[model samples]
Target: MRSAVTGTAVILAVGALVTAAMTTATASASPPAGPAKADPPRPVLVDCTWHKNVRPADFILACGDGNSRLIGLHWSQWGPHGATATGVNMVNDCDPYCAAGRFHAYPVTVRLDGPKPWKKDPSVEHYTRMSLTYTGARPDAFKAVMIYPLWD
Candidate 1:
């Protein structure tokens, strides 16, 4: 009977010690409660170079031949949904030939929308569509406003 009591007491003591140790460890291991670190800012646009940027001053529309481009971009808004800018659309006439074409600049209002994860870097977002409204004389045969699907 005495041995049984001693064994029970030993077991209870060991259990208490283990419980206290576990409580202390859990308390210490818990993360400190404070303001969480902010996530990195997502980009609104990806230029022809596949580089992410926000409110870029210039962007190329023609990645292959550099025939069309936007310059002097002044962004009015750059939010998660979309971005708006007023710039000049510079395009080559390609009158005689592409190599000898003359470049013309026209006033334009640009809108970037449909942001999606960039394939090259999933952590970053890039605009999937670009809409341009010509505020002045536009390129020949081109409409007053045009929408183009941006590269992923």
Candidate 2:
């Protein structure tokens, strides 16, 4: 009898949680609230033409993935295999809409690795991938090194 009662209680608790989650999800179905958003441009490199002296230490890169750009890049090491750079990526909480002005910054170690030929332009080379490993607080975030490809 006690085991049966316990099972019933567990089932009721799970049902309640499921119901609450459903309610929350349904309530947020409306369009996100925030400032007006301009259509995101195609996901291309912020600037494919980057040089050592000309490129700024910090810049805005619109990677049309509807997230955020890599901010505050301070390169400490550079080589053929990869370039180690310290930077900040503002993880945007695009609750409803991507262009919503909700962004949070976190320190990240960037790796521009796997040099490859610029398929279209044979004269130049590009980093096949860019990896980010967060070195700061991770609330609702991950410690994984997420790799993103770079394009001309």
Candidate 2 residues 1-152, lDDT tens each? Answer: 99999999999999999999999998799677888897532122235344322123664444456366777788886655667778887777776776665887878888776766556655555566778887866427565567777664
Global Cα RMSD, each model: 9.6, 23.1
lDDT tens per residue, model 1, 1-152:
99999999999999999999999999989997899898656556887777788889999999999999999999998877889999999999998998999999999999999988889988788889999999989998999999999888
Q: List where candidate 1 sits over 4 angstroms from the true fold.
A: 1-40
* lDDT values, one for every candidate: 0.91, 0.65
Best by lDDT: 1
- Candidate number of the best TM-score: 1
